[model samples]
Target: MKVIVIATAMFLAGAASVQAADKVTFQMDWLPGGDKAAIFVCLERGFCEDAGLDVSLETGRGSSESLTKLATGSSDIGNADIGALMAARVTENLPVTAVMSYYNQGPHAFFTLRGNGIEKFADVKGKHLVTSPFTSSNVYLPLVLNDNGLTMDDITLTKTDPGALNPMLVTGRTDAVISWITDVTRYTRQVEDAGREMIVLPWADAGLVMYSGTIVASDKFLAERPDVARRFVAALLESVKYMRENPQDAAQAVNDAVPELDHPTAMGSLQDAIGLIFNEVTERDGLGAFEPERLKATWDRVAAAQGLDADALDPESVVNRNFMPEN
Candidate 1:
């Protein structure tokens, strides 16, 4: 009887530990893809579980929609663009704050064939450009043009469905397409099949320095579950580090979670996107560090694009770095 009681107590303790794993809903700012491999890798490869978290994933259409979800408590924490968060803070005082910088540079870029007349930003003048109507990239288009010594008047712009932008560019229907570098492989594949090489003129290289995909959370989540939030951030950064070291397994994790996605395709996406996370800026500032000057510059551009007052946001108020773990 004494031996039986001991075994039963041990079993009950084991069950309790299992139940104690914190449940977290990680909202995705977009659908599952190579760029989104970080969250999926963490969940599928057991990083979140290792951190004592029972994480569930959710998909979103865009940063604006994801911000709405976070603001209303429909979700807890997710990846979003810092510029979107800044705009939201100005338009609506949402409680969401970015905790860690993910992509330290903006992914916005113009893709075209190298043989095309639009090899440089200055070359975009008097060329036909295509872009999707709903993308946040549209808001910053004017600023990119201004930096290149051009304006909306210089280019004949077409707003179309996202699916059609690349086709237009590759088929020579348009001279260039404004898109994100995250889709480099996808666009490359399409352009290659068309017997042309896809050339990406990234806005970051052309002077649009700002923070993109960042870890954002509702204020309530931070206040109510500080430990879980901290653990999640640590696990997320760990996943990114893992991705850098093991690109194959990291990309495979995405297909493991969403089997509809092809493995090689996802791998291509991961290869193109990994640089956005672990580049010169990351090396200089360290992972997830948002320098004061860059943060201010981000707000300045966001304000100019959205026509919001620069003083509308302090630039520092939209972020809370307390959730980031110490080295």
Candidate 2:
């Protein structure tokens, strides 16, 4: 009787272990794109499954909603922009931490028509521009304009959805749009199909560098499931490496998952976006670990625009390096 009871206890323990490894959810800030290099590759290659994570990828309305979901534990993990996260932390005591930053480039920028005779930033002084209502138009865009001897006063800034941008530009409803470079690439194709052309000015040109698509988790998750977080980051880093090695295949995977992104367009946009991915952090400090200098640069740009003290923000509080893989 004693031997039979011990056998039953061992069986239950094994079952519980398997159940524990069966689930995870990854919320994306947007539908799958080249920007989602690591996460998309991991899903396509089975790295997450092999790591014992049954992952689900859900779309977020935007970064703000994604981080909210993560903070409230509605999702296990999600991508966020460091800039948005910092602003939130200042206003609300957001209970979230960035485990890794995927895009070294923040992916925000201005776009223009090729034949507008406006090759230089100075020409934007009197142009019509499109931007999202929620983002840093009043804050960050001014810095770019000021840097070029222009300001919001210099141009007509139009608030529009990304879907409306292409039509607005093509129809002359707006002169240009401030948007993601990938989105610019999509618009580029639409314009080309309509016998027009566009130019992409990366955020790097204006000195407002930031990390986009950071992996974030709830504070509760960090405290309760450290091991699982570590595994997720490790698998993500592996996915990044895989995507870099197989850019064409990775692009195809993204196209397959996001059917709205037709094949040729997806391939071109992926090729354009690959340049924005920074391998520097992964090669030097390892993935997901916090870097103070980069954080400081981000804050400095924000301070220039918002008149906030750069030193007032605590970089360490927003980033947690404990879960990153040790080299």
Candidate 3:
């Protein structure tokens, strides 16, 4: 009888432990690709499991779309552009907050083929540019143009499906296409395959600095499961560190998870992604840290572009720094 009772207690304890694992649905801002290698690495390496999480990945139509999913509680967390999150907060009054910034330097940029005569930001004037309406780049184009001494009147803007932007540019239907700089490796390969040379004009270079990819959660989720959010961030940063330290293995892990991804392209994309993840700020403040001044600058610029009152929208309300891990 004593042995049976001990066995039953052990079984019940194991069952409770299994039931305690948090179910976290992580929505991606785009399709599963090389850009999301770090998240994939975390999932593949059992880091999330070790952190007491049962995390799942969902493909998102775009960054704004992902934010919508988080706002509606469809996803527990999401990786999205900070600009889009700000726009959503101002326009829809969503209670979503970003916790960790993965892309300290925003990836928004314009891609043009060499010899297109659009060598500088000023050259974009009087040229044809294609972009998707949902892209963060298009959403922030006004600010980018204004900062560079230009405006929408200076360029002919064409709206198209995200898939069509690259094709339209490569086929001469447009002079350039706006996209994320992280897509450089993939798009450059495509252009080279078509016998064309690709040139990227980064928004950061033109003084349109902002955070790009970040981990965000709805207010309800954070309020209810703060521990889970912290664990998720910790596991994610661990995966990022592992990825940075072991590029080749990390790339392989990504390719293994998403078999359709080309190994070499995955490696190159991860390398570029890492470059965006770390900088002097991240070095000094630690990874996943946000400088209040930098956040305020980005928020002000985004709010101004959207014609919203920057002072009314407190940056701290949009971002909660309490969730980041110490190391």
Q: Which is the leading candidate under TM-score?
A: 1
- Candidate 1 minimal-lDDT segment of 10 residues: 114-123
lDDT of 3 by residue, 1-327 (tens): 999999999999999998998999999988876678888888888788899998888998887788888988999887988877887887889989999988888788899999899888779999999988866677689988989899999999999888888888888999999988777888888899899999999888898876778889988899999999999999999998898888888888888888888789888788767778877767866788778888888898788877888776787778998899764
lDDT of 1 by residue, 1-327 (tens): 999999999999999989999998888988999888889889999999999999988899999889999989988999999999999998989899999999999889999998888777789988888999988899999998898888999999999999999888877899999998888999899899988987899998998988888999989999999999999999999999998899999889999989999898899989988878889999899999888999999999999999999888999998888888887
Off-target runs (Cα >4 Å) in candidate 1 are 1-7
Per-model clash counts, in order, read: 0, 0, 0
Q: Candidates' lDDT values, in order?
A: 0.90, 0.75, 0.86
What is the alpha-carbon lDDT for the whole of candidate 1? 0.90
- The estimated TM-scores of all candidates read 0.97, 0.86, 0.90
User: How does candidate 3 score on lDDT?
Assistant: 0.86
Best by lDDT: 1
Q: What tens-digit string does per-residue lDDT give for candidate 2 at 13-49?
A: 9788678774678888777776675677787787886
Ranking by TM-score: 1, 3, 2
Q: Score candidate 1 by TM-score against the native.
A: 0.97
